[model samples]
Target: MDNNGPAYHEMMELHEILNFKTLCLVKSKMMSGLVFDQDLKALMEKDVKQTTAAIQDLQSVYKPNGGIVH
Candidate 1:
Protein backbone atom coordinates (compact mmCIF):
# COMPACT_ATOMS: atom_id res chain seq x y z
CA MET A 1 0.00 0.00 0.00
CA ASP A 2 2.88 2.35 0.63
CA ASN A 3 5.40 1.42 -2.05
CA ASN A 4 3.46 2.84 -4.98
CA GLY A 5 3.49 -0.58 -6.64
CA PRO A 6 0.40 -2.51 -7.64
CA ALA A 7 -2.10 -3.58 -4.99
CA TYR A 8 -1.73 -7.06 -3.54
CA HIS A 9 -4.57 -8.42 -5.63
CA GLU A 10 -3.17 -6.89 -8.78
CA MET A 11 0.20 -8.43 -8.05
CA MET A 12 -1.42 -11.80 -7.62
CA GLU A 13 -3.12 -11.47 -11.00
CA LEU A 14 0.12 -10.51 -12.62
CA HIS A 15 1.79 -13.45 -10.97
CA GLU A 16 -0.76 -15.74 -12.53
CA ILE A 17 -0.09 -14.23 -15.95
CA LEU A 18 3.64 -14.48 -15.45
CA ASN A 19 3.30 -18.14 -14.59
CA PHE A 20 1.19 -18.82 -17.62
CA LYS A 21 3.60 -17.04 -19.92
CA THR A 22 6.49 -18.92 -18.42
CA LEU A 23 4.72 -22.18 -19.07
CA CYS A 24 4.04 -21.20 -22.65
CA LEU A 25 7.65 -20.22 -23.12
CA VAL A 26 8.85 -23.54 -21.77
CA LYS A 27 6.42 -25.55 -23.83
CA SER A 28 7.23 -23.72 -27.02
CA LYS A 29 10.94 -24.21 -26.52
CA MET A 30 10.41 -27.92 -26.03
CA MET A 31 7.98 -28.30 -28.90
CA SER A 32 10.18 -26.35 -31.23
CA GLY A 33 12.86 -28.97 -30.76
CA LEU A 34 10.46 -31.81 -31.47
CA VAL A 35 8.79 -30.24 -34.52
CA PHE A 36 9.91 -31.73 -37.84
CA ASP A 37 8.62 -29.04 -40.17
CA GLN A 38 11.02 -26.13 -40.45
CA ASP A 39 8.20 -23.59 -40.76
CA LEU A 40 6.41 -24.84 -37.65
CA LYS A 41 9.67 -24.92 -35.70
CA ALA A 42 10.39 -21.36 -36.72
CA LEU A 43 6.93 -20.28 -35.59
CA MET A 44 7.32 -21.93 -32.22
CA GLU A 45 10.73 -20.34 -31.78
CA LYS A 46 9.17 -16.96 -32.47
CA ASP A 47 6.49 -17.62 -29.89
CA VAL A 48 9.12 -18.61 -27.36
CA LYS A 49 10.97 -15.35 -27.90
CA GLN A 50 7.81 -13.29 -27.60
CA THR A 51 6.73 -15.07 -24.45
CA THR A 52 10.16 -14.55 -22.91
CA ALA A 53 9.88 -10.81 -23.54
CA ALA A 54 6.38 -10.71 -22.14
CA ILE A 55 7.46 -12.46 -18.97
CA GLN A 56 10.34 -10.01 -18.56
CA ASP A 57 7.95 -7.07 -18.88
CA LEU A 58 5.55 -8.58 -16.38
CA GLN A 59 8.38 -9.19 -13.95
CA SER A 60 9.33 -5.54 -14.10
CA VAL A 61 5.78 -4.61 -13.11
CA TYR A 62 5.14 -7.41 -10.63
CA LYS A 63 8.25 -7.68 -8.50
CA PRO A 64 7.33 -8.69 -4.98
CA ASN A 65 10.67 -8.75 -3.12
CA GLY A 66 12.44 -6.48 -5.54
CA GLY A 67 13.33 -9.64 -7.47
CA ILE A 68 11.90 -11.40 -10.48
CA VAL A 69 9.55 -14.21 -9.62
CA HIS A 70 10.97 -17.58 -10.57
Candidate 2:
Protein backbone atom coordinates (compact mmCIF):
# COMPACT_ATOMS: atom_id res chain seq x y z
CA MET A 1 0.00 0.00 0.00
CA ASP A 2 1.21 3.47 -0.83
CA ASN A 3 1.83 5.70 2.19
CA ASN A 4 0.78 8.97 0.62
CA GLY A 5 -2.61 8.00 -0.84
CA PRO A 6 -5.68 6.55 0.81
CA ALA A 7 -6.40 2.84 0.50
CA TYR A 8 -9.03 1.60 -1.94
CA HIS A 9 -11.79 1.30 0.64
CA GLU A 10 -10.99 4.66 2.14
CA MET A 11 -11.08 6.30 -1.29
CA MET A 12 -14.45 4.75 -2.02
CA GLU A 13 -15.84 5.99 1.29
CA LEU A 14 -14.46 9.45 0.68
CA HIS A 15 -16.02 9.49 -2.78
CA GLU A 16 -19.37 8.64 -1.28
CA ILE A 17 -19.03 11.42 1.26
CA LEU A 18 -18.05 13.89 -1.45
CA ASN A 19 -21.13 12.98 -3.47
CA PHE A 20 -23.35 13.37 -0.43
CA LYS A 21 -21.90 16.74 0.43
CA THR A 22 -22.29 17.90 -3.17
CA LEU A 23 -25.93 16.88 -3.13
CA CYS A 24 -26.54 18.65 0.15
CA LEU A 25 -24.91 21.80 -1.13
CA VAL A 26 -27.04 21.82 -4.26
CA LYS A 27 -30.25 21.12 -2.35
CA SER A 28 -29.56 23.83 0.19
CA LYS A 29 -28.87 26.39 -2.50
CA MET A 30 -32.06 25.51 -4.33
CA MET A 31 -34.24 25.39 -1.23
CA SER A 32 -32.94 28.66 0.11
CA GLY A 33 -34.68 30.45 -2.72
CA LEU A 34 -38.02 28.98 -1.70
CA VAL A 35 -37.65 29.70 2.02
CA PHE A 36 -39.78 32.59 3.23
CA ASP A 37 -38.21 32.90 6.64
CA GLN A 38 -35.06 34.98 6.73
CA ASP A 39 -33.51 32.90 9.51
CA LEU A 40 -34.11 29.63 7.71
CA LYS A 41 -32.77 30.98 4.43
CA ALA A 42 -29.67 32.30 6.14
CA LEU A 43 -29.11 28.93 7.77
CA MET A 44 -29.45 27.14 4.45
CA GLU A 45 -27.02 29.54 2.83
CA LYS A 46 -24.55 28.87 5.57
CA ASP A 47 -24.96 25.14 5.03
CA VAL A 48 -24.29 25.62 1.30
CA LYS A 49 -21.06 27.47 2.05
CA GLN A 50 -19.90 24.91 4.58
CA THR A 51 -20.81 21.97 2.37
CA THR A 52 -18.90 23.51 -0.53
CA ALA A 53 -15.82 23.74 1.64
CA ALA A 54 -16.26 20.19 2.86
CA ILE A 55 -16.48 18.91 -0.74
CA GLN A 56 -13.29 20.74 -1.64
CA ASP A 57 -11.49 19.32 1.37
CA LEU A 58 -12.68 15.81 0.59
CA GLN A 59 -11.54 16.15 -3.04
CA SER A 60 -8.13 17.29 -1.88
CA VAL A 61 -7.69 14.17 0.20
CA TYR A 62 -9.31 11.67 -2.17
CA LYS A 63 -7.33 12.47 -5.31
CA PRO A 64 -6.66 9.56 -7.65
CA ASN A 65 -3.33 9.65 -9.46
CA GLY A 66 -2.75 13.14 -8.07
CA GLY A 67 -5.76 14.64 -9.81
CA ILE A 68 -9.31 15.46 -8.87
CA VAL A 69 -12.19 14.53 -11.15
CA HIS A 70 -13.60 18.00 -11.38
Candidate 3:
Protein backbone atom coordinates (compact mmCIF):
# COMPACT_ATOMS: atom_id res chain seq x y z
CA MET A 1 0.00 0.00 0.00
CA ASP A 2 1.09 3.57 -0.56
CA ASN A 3 2.71 5.23 2.43
CA ASN A 4 0.50 8.33 2.06
CA GLY A 5 -2.77 6.41 2.18
CA PRO A 6 -3.40 6.57 5.92
CA ALA A 7 -2.59 10.24 6.20
CA TYR A 8 -4.78 11.01 3.22
CA HIS A 9 -7.68 9.09 4.73
CA GLU A 10 -7.31 10.83 8.07
CA MET A 11 -7.26 14.25 6.39
CA MET A 12 -10.33 13.38 4.36
CA GLU A 13 -12.17 12.25 7.47
CA LEU A 14 -11.27 15.44 9.27
CA HIS A 15 -12.51 17.49 6.32
CA GLU A 16 -15.79 15.60 6.33
CA ILE A 17 -16.30 16.15 10.05
CA LEU A 18 -15.60 19.85 9.68
CA ASN A 19 -18.14 20.07 6.89
CA PHE A 20 -20.72 18.29 9.02
CA LYS A 21 -20.10 20.56 11.95
CA THR A 22 -20.44 23.61 9.72
CA LEU A 23 -23.77 22.33 8.42
CA CYS A 24 -25.04 21.64 11.93
CA LEU A 25 -24.03 25.07 13.11
CA VAL A 26 -25.80 26.71 10.18
CA LYS A 27 -28.93 24.66 10.81
CA SER A 28 -28.92 25.52 14.46
CA LYS A 29 -28.65 29.19 13.64
CA MET A 30 -31.55 28.94 11.23
CA MET A 31 -33.70 26.99 13.65
CA SER A 32 -32.97 29.37 16.46
CA GLY A 33 -34.79 32.13 14.52
CA LEU A 34 -34.32 34.50 11.64
CA VAL A 35 -32.70 36.86 14.11
CA PHE A 36 -30.72 34.40 16.31
CA ASP A 37 -29.29 36.32 19.26
CA GLN A 38 -26.16 38.33 18.54
CA ASP A 39 -23.92 36.46 20.97
CA LEU A 40 -24.87 33.03 19.70
CA LYS A 41 -24.63 34.11 16.11
CA ALA A 42 -21.21 35.60 16.75
CA LEU A 43 -20.01 32.41 18.37
CA MET A 44 -21.29 30.26 15.53
CA GLU A 45 -19.76 32.57 12.95
CA LYS A 46 -16.42 32.42 14.74
CA ASP A 47 -16.49 28.65 14.85
CA VAL A 48 -17.39 28.43 11.17
CA LYS A 49 -14.62 30.84 10.23
CA GLN A 50 -12.07 28.94 12.26
CA THR A 51 -13.14 25.62 10.81
CA THR A 52 -12.98 27.02 7.29
CA ALA A 53 -9.50 28.34 7.93
CA ALA A 54 -8.42 24.97 9.28
CA ILE A 55 -9.70 23.20 6.15
CA GLN A 56 -7.87 25.66 3.98
CA ASP A 57 -4.69 25.15 5.94
CA LEU A 58 -5.03 21.40 5.59
CA GLN A 59 -5.52 21.73 1.86
CA SER A 60 -2.43 23.87 1.62
CA VAL A 61 -0.45 21.37 3.64
CA TYR A 62 -1.59 18.53 1.40
CA LYS A 63 -0.71 20.36 -1.77
CA PRO A 64 2.19 18.97 -3.79
CA ASN A 65 5.55 19.92 -2.25
CA GLY A 66 3.81 21.42 0.80
CA GLY A 67 5.63 18.82 2.89
CA ILE A 68 2.95 18.11 5.50
CA VAL A 69 2.60 14.42 4.68
CA HIS A 70 5.61 12.17 4.71
Each model's lDDT comes to: 0.80, 0.80, 0.62
Error of 2 at 58 (Å): 0.9
Clash totals in order? 0, 0, 0
Question: Residues 16-38, candidate 3, lDDT per residue (tens digit)?
Answer: 76577667657755654664588
> How far does residue 6 in candidate 1 sit from its true spot (Å)?
1.5
Candidate 1 least-lDDT 10 residues: 61-70
Residue range 1-70, candidate 1, lDDT tens digits: 3755556777788878889999888889887888999989888988888898998888776786643344
Candidate 2 TM-score over all chains jointly? 0.82
Query: Candidate 2: how many backbone clashes?
Result: 0
Please list all clashing residue pairs in model 1, or write none if there are none.
none
Any idea what lDDT model 2 has? 0.80
**TM-score: the better of candidates 1 and 3:** 1
